[model samples]
Target: MVLKRVRANFKRFIKSNAKGQTTTEYILILFVVVMVALKFRGLMKEKITSQMDTLGTKIEQITNDSE
Candidate 1:
């Protein structure tokens, strides 16, 4: 009887703990995505700034030509 009770409790414990595996997987995926984003953020910002600067220069040239 004691062995049976222990086995039942072990089953319950296993069932209750099963969700942690999925939660851990999701957290790991989220962490990887955030790390990738952080790594590329500076490159993305630089590209955007360069594009804006080029656009500004073109706009200034067009305005000067018009004037």
Candidate 2:
């Protein structure tokens, strides 16, 4: 029957090469993460720079006090 053949083919397709499909999914997720990072790259840079500046100021104050 036509319906039986279609069902059988669908099952076969679903069973075929599951490992490859899983890898593809992982790669897709990584791509999305990378894209998001790129989109926020400027914001991340500014925040990191601000934090570093604050850290440097604190370190300078500590050294001056010890001296």
Candidate 3:
């Protein structure tokens, strides 16, 4: 009957669209991860630079003391 045919088509449409929805969700998650990584990168760079500077100062002091 016509009702059965309509139901069948609706089911097919939903099945096809599910993949697209899942792909969109994955893309959104990936975007969020990339954004967070970029934000942290700057903070990490600053901390590394500060640590290296501190280490260099200590080494210099030690050298001066030795001489």
lDDT of 2 by residue, 1-67 (tens): 9999998886676579797567768999999999999999999999999999999999999999999
Q: Which ten residues in a row have the lowest lDDT in candidate 2?
A: 8-17
- Tens digit of lDDT per residue, candidate 1, span 16-38? 88786577679899999999999
lDDT of 3 by residue, 1-67 (tens): 9999998886777678988668767999999999998989989899999999999999999999999
Pairs in clash, predicted candidate 3: none
Please identify model 3 stretches exceeding 4 Å from their true place: 1-35
The models' CA-based lDDT, in order, is 0.90, 0.91, 0.90
The TM-score leader among the candidates is 2
Worst 10 residues of 1 by lDDT: 13-22
Clashing residue pairs in candidate 2 (N, C-alpha, C atoms within 3 angstroms)? none
Comparing 2 with 3 on TM-score, the higher-scoring candidate is 2
Measured against the true structure, the TM-scores of the candidates, in listed sequence, are 0.53, 0.76, 0.48
